[model samples]
Target: MAGTSTGVLMAELTTTARATRVIAAVVGVALLLAGTVWGQDDKFPFGPFSMYAGVNGPNEPAPDTRVEGTDSTGRVIVLAERNAGVRRAEIEGQEGAYVDDPSRLARIADSYQRLNPGAPPLVKVALIVREHEIHNSSATGRWWDDVRAVWDRPA
Candidate 1:
């Protein structure tokens, strides 16, 4: 009788241990999924330019400028100053305009030329982030990926 009881107790202990491990694993996976979902909702705030094309003064840097824009359909127009009398610009956008619009690139070039005609010629100007993340706490598992573009200038 004693031997049988001991064997039964040992079996129950093993079963309990397995159940605990499984529960832990499930909880870990659930937390991971929640974290990923939360991360996708994160947002970074951008800016408010004075003139669409002007000597816009410096602004705050946005968080994670390395990450590309989520609006893949929208275009990213970058104008950089290349040298004394030259500037470089590129427009990356969805496929429609490139095929249909003949004046788009020319318009951009003309705008830059008109804006900085006599000035140093915008030696280098590009679409860049000027803001950063503003977090209140250091707690782990907080999601952060959304981007908000505000028109108000930073103080």
Candidate 2:
């Protein structure tokens, strides 16, 4: 008798698990549809997959940007390495903000010098973004860089 009861319980548990999976799948499909039909402005809690279009194929140019700094002695340094833990994406997204108010860049420079006491004093900081063209995804092509932003310390 006990064996029979345990068997019934196991069957019920299996059925419940199947139902949960179906419900989860349905909910996922609904979210995908809503995200696509509504708008790409983050209607859902997460996102609509900004770059769902996939890569730029085998031949294209990708963006590569970083901050370069000039030390007090005229030595070049990568400001991104000592940017007070700010990532490249965050800074790039805030490009307009930085351009509007360059004082923020100054604060970041100060943070870099403070964190790396042994490093030389940073006098100028420039954000450079480069575009590198790729050929057949196997070889790199022509590349060009642009100076997006530049900041210097007070005399």
Clashes of each: 18, 0
In candidate 2, what are the lDDT values of residues 102-143, reduced to their tens digit? 667776687788888888888888777788888888547689
List the global CA lDDT of all models.
0.35, 0.72
Write one digit per residue (lDDT tens) for candidate 1, span 1-155: 22474465333447889899999999877766665555222211122221233332234222332112111224333444331222221222212342254333344344555755753222222223334433343323333443322111112
Error of 1 at 94 (Å): 24
Stretches > 4 Å off in candidate 2: 1-60, 81-83, 135-139
After superposition of all CA atoms, the RMSD between model 1 and the true structure is 19.9
**How many angstroms is residue 141 displaced in model 2 relative to the true structure, after the best TM-score fit?**
3.2
The lowest-lDDT stretch of 10 consecutive residues in candidate 1 is 41-50
Q: Clash number for model 1?
A: 18
